[model samples]
Target: MSRDGTSASRNAPLVGTLLVLGYCVINSTKSVFEGSLVQHLSPEFIAFNSFVLAQGFYFMICRDKAALLATVRRCLPDVIALNVATMVSWVAVLYAFTVFEPAMANSVILGLVPSITIALGFKLRPGVRALRLEVVAALGMLAAMSFLVAAAWNGSSAIGDLPKDDLAAGLIYCVLTSFALSAITYFTRRLGDQGMSVQQMMASRFGVLILVTLGLLIGRDSFDAYTPRNIGAILLISIVGVIVSLYLLQAGMVRTEPITVSMLFGTNLIITYVVQFLDPRLHQSTTTFVGVLVLSAAMCLGAWARWRDGRDNPPAGVPDKVPAEVPAEAEGTTQNVGNRT
Candidate 1:
């Protein structure tokens, strides 16, 4: 290789790491934005509008319309499953945000996603096994969640007092969010394994969700919620949260190791807490802060575990070049729309 080419190859991982970091920072703010939007616009309206905007964006940038249609047709069942899972997860998290403080909701609820995904993976894939460190990390994150729970129970939450019934309901919604997100992740990986590109998946994943949210808006008579300000907010979030962040993640994962991507994403908890701290409407209690720290650590540990496993079991040989038909799963990039929160 030429010297410049060699230099570029060496720097690719660094560039990818920076891109993923940018994604983490951008994605971390999603909950805060959605929380604010939900207070003015119904969750259904926000969801409906966001999905519509995102769908348009994806369609514009989609490179191979024919390939996307063919993939959807070939994997019609999986596409439907993915859409249902994304809808449930999206709506559940939005409802949870309405009940819990945005940052707190992110920490206490969305924080459980990795662990839940692990559990789901174990159950769904019989031959798969989790690393010891992953199990420990999952348990640690669960334990850390208790501190936030305790704060809420004692009426000492950082976001101010929440009603007990609402808190209970929010917890239930959180559970639903976690499970649905895990399912979405699982379906995303399965589709990737079956030859769907990330763009193809994103382009087709929201059909059911759009229909459901539209029905909800009609039933609630929420057309009035689409004021100029609300519309602007939806557009901004769709551009920043859905389109830009996913693009960065996809580009970064293509060049970086999966472990590095995982580790960078783990920092999202801290970034989210910091964003919440800056927002005048939200506050972080000491216990909740500590819990966030622990959860972040747990996430890092889990990433390390996965990395170690891969290292210990390297592929038998490196290919000179990737096969043309290899899917995104083989390339170490998978769609994860759940981060849009």
Candidate 2:
């Protein structure tokens, strides 16, 4: 009994680490393309592309359309909240880049997300406990993040480094962006709260994001900006940056500790950290290591918590132990869909 418990406990952090590392590689794979696309592509296009791809994947992978449609319909209201939040995060991040250095802006804005996720995770699961082992792991990763930050300082040249004013601006942007993401995570968790499956939640997030961003694009007069270069960027953004990135992320969310991986996701900041060495013209900072360390520690802690909490996660197709008040229609639809699948 003791050995089994020890093994499971050990597996918890391993799962969490792998989850973050996987996403790091996924997001990093296209980081080069991502920065340029963000500059050139319309927000609406990016949002639309990602959401469509996400939904396409969801619909294809879902075993049952009945349940999918039912959950989507039932969960639509909550998804709007998520879409708005994410839309804001996207816009702010782009704008932040204008005023702050990308690395600095990413460090603060992206770093805040993990902390927000951890906070929201607990808000969603009030009964979840904090574990000591996870805390140690968080510390270790934080030390690593510090190394990365230092590595960044020691590392890049092409990226922006936030000056005092830029740092201030970055913080302001990061805080708001963090708030927006809190909503994204919170509402998605609420979708889960409403008895929607992962498929339903991912589908709704994509569908709503696409619709909303498309509407915004039309209104913002961003249509005339399209050139062949922009068109290809949007397509690439959709296929690699948006769809593939989101698919990997959502899958990670489903399979592992979301808050933990979310925290570890702070590594996304200096997307060019390691590669910038080839150029040697990129800006590097020594403090980046310390910042990375702090961020990593927080994420590892969050992952540990998520792993510990996952044990209590309701099995597939079951309500949480507390019993969410799902609508009768929702229950029927889920059952119908499950049966069909």
Candidate 3:
């Protein structure tokens, strides 16, 4: 790659790492408080309210209409696709949680995100290639997630005990959720590369999300489920989970490789696993502890691959920074040469 390409590539991963950490931190904190709220309201109701508040906040923070319009004009298809992915993923995950255990459903579905993102990037992303090591790292992440789920699995509970209808429906929803998340990771990087800010991408994304949620609320008659307490909780979830998390994700997407984002995003559950250990009701078995260690190792491997790739493939057009003293030195030399002349 040329200098500019090399520089961009190098910078992208660093940006991605910071943003992923931001996403993880903010979302993990929000999640700690989310369980109680979920019990009081339907997923759709909570989702709708959260986006409505988030969208409103986005408008307040993003005041430059001209730039926003230009971004929309330039990346309409991508923006729309991204919003659809967001909407679909949220709805699918919420529905899946209704039919399956939260840990089991999330583990199975989210584990697919890294692989799907890699596959999609290979097929759809021009000029972007997946390295063998990257692929292996992604698979490792999936394996680690599976192990986490296994650790949480109750030996007494069997798949046969789940109603066949609910199981099939949950599986379908889970698949959709995984594919939608894959799309989000891919498109987020695409838009970020196109020079859109996290705020701009988030504002547009939430704008669409609000509309989608509204339609769902009206169509499903879920308004009756919302209470004053749930309303407050949903607002909180929106500000932290929807707004902050999505912004960090977009910011990170702009800087990092998509696969890195996918792999790291899958690890968000690590926070939940840690929180579980604090609760007497949520016991951590020897298997769960082992799974946590494996998950940590997988994340380390994926991060290393990303770092190596960035170093190896720098972006063109970015020149090395000139020494600040060079201009002054040249001016002094020019004066001396003039005196001699």
Candidate 4:
């Protein structure tokens, strides 16, 4: 290779790391913004606008129309399944944000995603072996989530004066988000195995939600909600959170190791908590502090376990082993765990 080529190759990982970190920070901040927007705009309206804008952006930038169309036609069922999963996840997480603090909602959804994905992976693919460390890490995350739920139930959460009923509903929505995301990850992987690129998958994944959300908007005549301010907010989030964030993630995944990507993405929790703390509108309690700490630890442990597994069982002909639980791209929302919305 030329000297310049060698230099560029050497710096690729660093560049990729920076891009992924940028994605983490941007998505985390967008989650807080979504929470605030939900106070004025219904989750369905926000979701509808986000999907429509993202679809437009993806369609315009997509370079391989022939390849994308071939893949969609060949794997039509899987494509539909992935779109359905994305729709459910986007709606659930957005609704969850309406009731829960953005930080708390992000923490629960991102923190529990790996565990949920792992469990579902095992159930769907019985022959795959589960790592002992990964199992322990999953249990730790569950326990931490349980503690956070208990805190919310007793009204001792960092978000002050949350009604128990609303909090409970929010938590349920978070769980639903996790499940939908797991399904999204699964279907994304399946389509990948069938030769679909991340860009193609993204281009195809929003169609179902676009139709569903558009129908709801038309039925309710929610176009009145599209004031200048709301349009600006939705466009900002769709551009930064959905389009640019997922682009960064896809680019980073190509150059960086999966373990690095997992760890960097895990930092979203801290970034989110700090942003929430700075926002005067949000509240933080002692339990919230402890919960963040616990969730962070759980995330690190899970990342480490995945790293160790890759080390012990390196895939043949592959230089970097992809983390099994981290999805390569996020759709719709700004916070989709590994992909982050």
Q: Which candidate ranks first by lDDT, i.e. highest?
A: 4
Number of backbone clashes in candidate 1: 0
Q: Rate the local accuracy (lDDT) of all candidates.
A: 0.75, 0.52, 0.60, 0.75
Tens digit of per-residue lDDT, candidate 1, span 68-175: 899999999989998998898888889887887765676666467757766677676545676778778778878887778888878766667888899998898888
lDDT of 3 by residue, 1-341 (tens): 89999998778678778877777766644544543344445677777777778777886788897999899889999999988888888777777766554444555565565577667765767466666675776687589666644443443122224566776787777789878877776676678767776667767885565687788788977774456766667776876677667666656655654446545654555665565444333334455545555655555565566656656875687544322212110110001100000
Give the alpha carbon lDDT tens digit for every residue of 5-61 in model 2.
889766855764665466565555444444445555654665566556556866677
Off by over 4 Å in 2: 1-20, 29-32, 40-45, 49-66, 114-170, 224-226, 249-272, 275-281, 305-341
User: Pairing residues by index, what is the TM-score of model 4?
Assistant: 0.91
> So what's the TM-score on candidate 3?
0.72
How far out, in Å, is residue 117 in model 1?
Answer: 2.4
Point out the higher-scoring one by lDDT: 2 or 4: 4
Backbone clashes under 3 angstroms, per model: 0, 23, 15, 6
> Candidate 3: global Cα-lDDT?
0.60
**For all the candidates, what are their Cα RMSDs to the real structure?**
2.9, 9.1, 12.7, 3.5
Q: Estimate each model's TM-score.
A: 0.91, 0.63, 0.72, 0.91
Evaluation by lDDT, superior candidate among 2 and 3: 3
